[model samples]
Structure formats: C-alpha cells, structure tokens
Target: MPSTPSIPPWDVHRPPPGHGKVFLITGGNAGIGYFIAEQLSAAGATVVLGSRNPAKAEAATASIRARVPGAQVRTVRLDLADLPSLRTAVEPLGAERLDGVIHNAGVALDDPPREETREGHELMFATNHLGHFALTHWLMPLLSAAPAARVVTVGSFAAKTERLDPDDLQSRKEYVPKRAYGRSKLAQMYFGLELDRRLRAAGSAVASVVVHPGGALDSLTPSRPPVHVRTAGARLRGAPAALLVQGKDAGAWPAVRAVLDPDVRGGELWGPRVFGLRGRPRRERVWTHLTDASAATRLWDASRDLTGVDPGRLP
Candidate 1:
C-alpha cells in the first residue's frame, strides 16, 4: 500500500456542470441512491436508475424529471438478491456505452438465523457484494468503451471491525446479522481496491474507487430496535453517532465525489473527515490490510466461482 494514498478534495455538495455523460446508479429510487441520481441528472448527465420495484423506479425518475425538468433519466429493474434477475436487468442496457457505475444498492439482514438468496449465498453477502460483482462484470464492456469510465462502490466504516471469513463466506456456520453485514461491506471495499489492482495490472482503462458514508442515514440497512439501542449508546459516549447520520443528499456526497472527481485514482477511498462518523466529503486512506494482495487474489477467485463470471474476459 502507498504510504500516503491520494486523497482528493472536492465540493461534493455542488458538482460541476456535466456534458451529457452517461451514469448508471443502482438502488436509485430512494435514499442515497435517489439523491445521487437526482444530482447527476441536474448536472446534465444521462441517468439510468437500476431498481427492483418498477413503481419506485418510475417514481424516482419522475421526481428527478420534475426537479430538473427535461433531465434525461431512465429506469431498469434490478433485484440484487436474485442473480438471474441481475443478468436480465443488464441486458437491455448492454449496448450503450456507460460512463460510470455507482454500486449503491445493498441490504442489511438483521433477521435471526442466516438467510440465503436464490443462488444459495448468504443474503447480505449476496446483495451487497456478489450482486454488484456480477453487475460490474457484465457491464465491463460498456464501461471500457467510454473514454474514461469509473466504478464507485459504497462501503462502510463498520468494515474496520470485520474481516473476510473464507470458511463462512455464506455465513452458514455462524450467523451474526450485523457482523455479516459488516463483512460483506468489507468485501466490497476489498473488491474495489483489488479490482483496481487487477485493472492496472491488466492495463485496463476503467478506474475503480470505493467510498463510505461514514455513518450516513441509509434506508438500505434496517434500523431495528437493537440497532437503535446501540446507536444511542454510542451517542451517550460522545461518539457523535446517530440512528442514521447524514441526510440523504449529504449521504450521497462521498459517492458523488468518487464518481465525478477527475483526479480520483483506483484504490482510493473517500469519506467524511470527522471520526468517520459523519461530515462532508474528504478522501481518506483505508486500513493497510484491505490492500493485501493475497486476500484480493483469493477474493477474486471466490467471486468468479460464485458468480460464474470471469471479469478478465470482459471487454
């Protein structure tokens, strides 16, 4: 890992005017994703929202259209829990060259007992990691065709407390809901860094970066009683915690910076400056272990096996 990772400064709250760039944002119908789509559209980019609910997707785009009257926005169906649905979702947009992908869709499984997806993987890992993995693989061609394309994935500060458990990648043996979610988010951050390494090694032009909201308010993660209790406890300790930290628009800033900042590099991480709890967008270095080459190689192999998609073969 570089002794000092490049941390670019940017005004994420206010993006510069776009020149008709094409952007695809998953989970764009609500919360952070919705705000990201809205901001990008307002900047004059052609926005495509990938959502599971047709009504929600339509509503999201409509809302953006209302605000940015004539904003170029479209909607597509995407269900991260179902691998087959992901494949079907990308087919329609495969032909178009994409400028960037904001992998904002994810799920936090707080339910008791471990749950699996249609592909038999742990629910949290499936939705948060594998789903985005498969989507990025399938869309590689579109990403590569662009002059300069980017792939930004949302991770979390909770990743610091979690490590990838190869033995229980699916959380089958020991299932701790919050821990599982953290592990999955950790996997995402790892994948983003590792993908950047591989892309540089393979001489691919696509740039990959990861961002964390640093305790932003997200609807994607469930806010059950236990979660709230823990959050309250943190606040009592002067930790500056919230059941959900930043507002929806503010939460989207880190990701927006990672995607739009011209100076961003592969493996770079952007997040809030304050104790990683909540603040404005700022580039920050991730833990050294996350850049472990060996772990990344193992993860790449595991992801390929799980998704049955070879990213190397992508255009």
Candidate 2:
C-alpha cells in the first residue's frame, strides 16, 4: 500500500485462525505449496490443495489435517502443464467465493533439453506462466464474488536478472535452462502487475500481488509422514547447498503474506528480507522491466493469443 510496505506475519506465522476464508493453492502436494496449505489450514481456513495427482493431493490434505485436528482442507486434481487439465481443475472450485488463489506451481529445467507443453509452448513457460494465466482468467467470477479477494503470484529471483523476449517466448531459437526459467518468471510478474492495473480501471475489488519465496529446499525443510519423503539428495542434509537454502516453511512466507497480510497492496512485489535467500517477508524492489506498461501489455496480449482464453469480464 505504501512505497515501502511493512508486513508482520500473522495467519501463517502466528497460527491465527483464518476461519471462513477459502483459499486455493496450486502444486500444494509438496514443496513450499504444501507448507502454505498447512499454515492456512492450521489457522482454520478451508484450503483446496490443487495437484495433478489425486493421491498426492490426498496425502497433502491428510498431512495438514493430521497435524491440525479438525483442519478444513480438501484436494483437487490440477495439472499446470496442460490447459485442459487446468480448466477441469477449476470447475469444482468455481462454486465457492474464494478469498485467494496462490499461483505457486512451477518447474525448473536444470540443464535439460528444451521441451514443449501439450499446448506447444515451452515447458517452463507453460507450466510457470501460461497455465496460471489461463487458470486466473477462468476463475475471475468466483474471485469477484468475494467481498474482497487477492491473487498471489509466486515468482522467482530469476526475474531480477532476466527479461522476456517477446519476439521469441519459447526459446525455440536457442534454449538455455536458466534464461528460459527467467523469462517465464518475468512474464508471471508482468501478469500480476498488469492484472492489478486492469482490476483498478474496471473498479474490481480483487487485488493481485507478486512474491518470491527465497530459495526453498525440499530436503532441509521439516518432514511430515506420508507427505514429505526424502530424496537421495536429501541424504546430504547439512551440506552447503542445503544450508544456503531455507526450509519450505520459511520459503512459503512471502506468498502466504501476500494472501493474508493487511498491509500488502496490489501491483507490489515482495520477497524474503535477507537478499532473496532466507528471512521474513518484506517489500522487495521490483525489476525495472516489470514497471514498463508496454512490456506488460505485450505480455498480456501474447498470453491471450497463446491461450485462446480470457479472464472473463474482469478485463
């Protein structure tokens, strides 16, 4: 809300009851997303953990409920890699007036060959940006139905160093894993900031904000049975790599704050206070490209053309 907003974590950090509020999180099956689900559910909110696998979603919901007795949580199958899957995943959630939707599902292609989505876009772009664009577009009504709502877009530190090449979004020309990942994340921030401008122009009550969870470590974070399982890399728990990364619980703070913090404002970017690594949430300086209206418009137009969908009348 201010040039420099002050955020004091309440719901997620203090475990204050969220009571009647309904929030949906993509990729809630594991990683940082699951911790957000647990934090919100522990605070008494009804959380819908969206994942591609029903089994995994059930495990996540069960994990939260087990930890917080009588916690209200459910699961929905959502696959961000495919557009049709996202459409089907949102159907059941449309009936309720949602308090927030955290776009946290993402994929990082490390030294892997360039891949494409079912829709024919770059794998990272589709999963990280396009799918979320389509999801938010389709769910606008339910968002509008709420007295006031928020859309928390989980972004990455990559945005600061990388910019999207509107001329070639797919990286078909030349694929570099890190650059491709950065483009997708930058596009995500563009959407979040642009959506806020559009919502304000149309007199909508919903707000959109972008946040980056500091480097989140799957192995270093606390493990909950039947949900979080250790990987081979996890065996090196106290290694430098693990030590540098924050646990999933701390990493989930920025997004959770965007959804619950009263002081957070639309169109603002927030990240961990400690150099995008591990710390409490704070108002982080945004990349210059994110402030460009023309760039945002270009991203918005291209996203619509690629998805062949709209966020309904809200636009």
Candidate 3:
C-alpha cells in the first residue's frame, strides 16, 4: 500500500471542528470512551453513547452536556455480548448516515475460571472481538452512507507482546484471564487492519483505523462527577506514575484523532507519542504481529463463522 504523506501533528485541544458530523462510540459512557465523547461533543459533533446500561449512558450524556453547554449527545442501549440483540441494538441509530463508529467497548477478566456468553463463546473474545465484528456488519450501511466515514478500533498496549493462537482463539484449551484478555484485544487490532484492507479493495469511502490507549490510569484521570471521580489522595499517589502514564482523557486522544483527522489513513496504528505511553497521539508503525495477513484472514474467517456476519460486504 502507498504510504500516507506526512502532515502536521494533531493538537488534541484544538481538534478540527466537527460541527456537522455524527459519531457513535461503543462504551462511550465511561473511561476513555467518555472522554472521546466529551471532546468531540465540545467540537460540535452529535455524539451517541452506546452502552448496555441506559442510566449510566444518561449520566455520561449529562456530564458532556454540562461541560460542553450546547453539546448534542444521545444514548442507545447496546449489549455487545448479546449477539442476537445487536441488530436491534442499532435500530435507535436511525436511517441517517453515521460519520464514524469507535469500537471501544471491551471486557477484561482479571482472574478466572473463564466465562462464556450465553452464546457459548469465551466472554473476553466474544465481547472484545466478535461483538464488534458483528456490529460492524450491521453498521456498514450507515457508515458507507456518509461521504467519508471512519471506524476506530481501540486496542490495548497489553496486546503488544501477546500472540494469538489460531487453534485456540477462544482459549478453549487453556484460559488465563489476563492472557485471554490480551488475545481478545489482539483479535480486534487484526480486525481493524483487515477491515481496512477489504475496504480499499472494494473501493469504499469508509476507513478503518486502529489505536491503543497507553497506560491510561484512572488515578491520574480527572473527575467528571457522576461519570468518574478522582480523589485528592488518589491524585497525590498517581502523581509519581504521571511521569510514564496519563489519564484516561489523554488516552482517548489517539482514537479521537483517528476519527477526525483527514490526513489519517486506514491500516495505520496510533498511540501515545512518548515511548508509546504518555504523551500526545502519534501515528505509529503497525506492529509485526498485527502485520500478518494470513493470520488476520484466518481470524476474519473465524469471526464470520462465529458471528455469521461478513463485514466486508458494504451497503
């Protein structure tokens, strides 16, 4: 693929104004997703928060409205783990075109015995990878309807050194909570790149970009009332970690840039600029593990088999 020409670095504070665009962010009710919504809303984009909990989504919407005054924000009930409901989950999004979709919602099991969704897929893999994959299939029409649309997949720094086992993608043979989580995220990154490749081949206007939030610590994050609260003691304790990490708000910069930056191209990776951990967003080279076209294809094929949806077919 041809390399994208270099452009001026994006200023997080002054993102290109998004007055007329509409963006849907899965899991936008809290954490980094909340910050992504807040920033884009501040810039005048109609931001929709997709979450399983309506009340929490409302709280996030309220927080953004309070902070951004005339911000246009809405909420849609979405449960990625519940595959059958996804088609209906997006019904509220309407027939209007969608400018962007951020595949940011995910689940991480810290310890385990491993769990499975009602559909019998591993919890982490189902929610983190397959759910977004299925959702993309449903949302393609809305996305393609736009003059230019982008899909930003939020991956994890944990997946940097993790490798996926094609034979055990669901961790059926052996399931370690942390490792399972990492593999799930790695699958998401693969999907983003693969989706982009398919888009380019099909000559679609929509773009798919991937990003990772580097060391986003809640202790260092600022409070947003009902959405999140960081105590003074927490701030003091996290001050030391600040040298190498950033708050969730800062962690959201890369995804926001991927969505709004006109110069950003598909099949590219974005992350924190400083040591890939604690600075402004910068376009990073695609990781080696993520560059394996064969693995990505296998994963894509497996995802389609599991979800029964082919995202490559656009409307």
Candidate 4:
C-alpha cells in the first residue's frame, strides 16, 4: 500500500468562483446531491442537475434558484438504474461542454433478495458502480475537451467494512443488503482510482477523484414541500443524535472538496476529517481491495463488456 499524507482543512462554503465552468451532478434532486448542486450553482457554475424524474429535478432547480437568485441551473433526467433512461437523460448534454462531472446518484441501501437492474446486474452494483462507469465513458470526450476537467465520484464509509468477491461480482451466490451496498461503494472507489491512473498514463488532463459524505441524514434538510421524506428522520436527528450526524449540506463537503479544491490530485480518496463521519474534508485511504490494481482492471474491463462502450477513445 502506498502511503498518503493527510489533507488540509476544507471549507465547503469557500469554493472558488465557477463563473465559466459547467458542472453536471447526478441525483441532484435531493439529499447530498441537491445540496451539492445548490452550493455549486451558488458558486456561479452552470450546473446540470440530473435526476430520474423531471418534475423532481425541476423542483430542486427551482429551490436552488429561490435560494440563490440568478443561479444558472438546468434539469436533465438521469436514471442510474436503467440504461435506456441514462441514454435519454444524457441527450441534452450532448452539445453543452462540461468542466466537471460528479457521479453522486446511488441507492444507499435496500432490503435483501438481491434485485437485478434492467441490464441484468445486481441492483446495488448496477446503480452505485456500473451506472457511473457507463456514464463516464459516455462523457469522457467532453470532459477531456475541457482543460483539466475532473470526475468526482461520491463513495461511502461502507467501503471500509465490506469485502468484494471478485469472482461473484454480481452477488449471485449470496446477498445481504448492507454488504452488497458496501461492495458497490468499494467498487466505485476502485474504479475512480483506476481511472485516475489510466488518464495520467495517457497524459490526459482529466482527473478522477473519489470522496465520501460522512453520516449525512435527510432529516437535517429543510422540508421540500409535496415530498414527505421519512418523518422519522426529523426525530432521529433530534437531541444529541444531531451533534453526531451531519446535515446533507455539510455531508457534501468532501465531494465539494473533490469538485473545487485546486490542490486535490487525481486518485485521491477524501472524506470527513473527524471520525470519517463529520467535519471538513480530509484525505483518507480506502480498503486495500480498492487499491488492488488487478481488481480494478478486472472491474473496468467487465464494465466495458457489460455496457458495450469503450472509454478508450479519450486518451
């Protein structure tokens, strides 16, 4: 394992002005994704808020504009669970050049019985890892075209406790919801790191960085009318529990760091500076599984085979 130095403190509110940059954030309709989009658009970036539902995305965009007057925000329908939905969702971005893309959409957890995506992969794996993989391949050129573009993937602390069975990448033999979720997150981090290495080797200016939002809860978010989030969320966030957990906006700091921090290098993994669950962004190491070069390569190859799309054209 290579040693990595700790990162400096990051203030998510202090992102550099993004007047000329164009950013795309998947799952921007709610949760940390929405907050990230809010912060980015407030910073003056022309942000493409990608969501599975057009109405929800529009609602989020309106909320952003209401909060940050004159913000440049557009909605794009992106469904990570469906490949066809991804294609239709990405059509609008074909002509708009992007300076950065954040793969932030994913299923946090699900009950057992391991469901399969439309593409016939494990549901968690398909949404959390493969969807981002295929999306990246689709946008590689536009990314490479921009000078020093970045790809920031939102990973999770679940990676630390999980083990990936490379042989059964799809969880066919066994399936536990949390374990499956953790494996998917680990795969995301692995893919991001491997992409960084590949882009660097190819002498491409694009950088791939992965980050995890600490224990962020939806309860901390202000109510978005018409959508009833788990009401229990607000209760769970009460009293001392609130201190340990971070709000959705604060949880987005690591990803915000990955997106805007100029000093951040490719292949770096960043998360909360305090206990890996709260505070400003700090550099961290993921499980050795994510650092295993061979495993990453296998995942990358498998991704291309499944998606039938090659990201090789970028370099």
- Worst 10-residue stretch by lDDT in candidate 3? 87-96
Candidate 3 per-residue C-alpha lDDT over 190-210 given as tens digits, one digit per residue, 9 for 90 to 100: 999999999999999999999
- What tens-digit string does per-residue lDDT give for candidate 1 at 137-200? 8889889998888999999888988888777787888888999999999998888888887788
Of 3 and 4, which scores higher on TM-score? 3
lDDT of model 2 at residue 177?
94
Which residue runs does candidate 3 get wrong by more than 4 Å? Answer: 1-8
| Model 4 C-alpha lDDT per residue in residues 1-315, reported as the tens digit of each score | 987988655557778788888899999888889888989988888899888889888888888888899999998878788865665566788545678999999895668677887678888899888888888888886898888889999988878887778788888888888888888988888888988998888898999998999788766655555332546646564535567767778888887778787898898989888888888888887656677888888888887887777564473
Per-candidate Cα lDDT values, in order, are 0.80, 0.84, 0.95, 0.82
Q: In model 4, where is the ten-residue run with the lowest total lDDT?
A: 221-230
TM-score for every candidate vs. truth? 0.87, 0.91, 0.97, 0.91
Q: Any runs in candidate 1 off by more than 4 Å, and if so which?
A: 1-9, 218-244
Most accurate candidate by TM-score = 3
* Sliding window of 10 residues with minimal summed lDDT for model 2: 7-16
lDDT tens digits, residues 1-315, model 2? 467776544544674457899999999988889999998887788899988889989888878988989998888888888887666677887456889999999998899688987678899999999999999987888899888899999988777888778799889998999999988988888899898888988899999999988787776778787787666567475457654567788899888878877778988998887777878888877768789999899889988888888663483
The candidate with the higher TM-score, 2 or 3, is: 3
What global local distance difference test value does model 3 have? 0.95
Q: Model 4, residue 94: what's the lDDT?
A: 56
Worst 10 residues of 1 by lDDT: 221-230
The candidate that achieves the highest lDDT relative to the unseen native structure: 3
Q: Clash pairs of candidate 3?
A: none
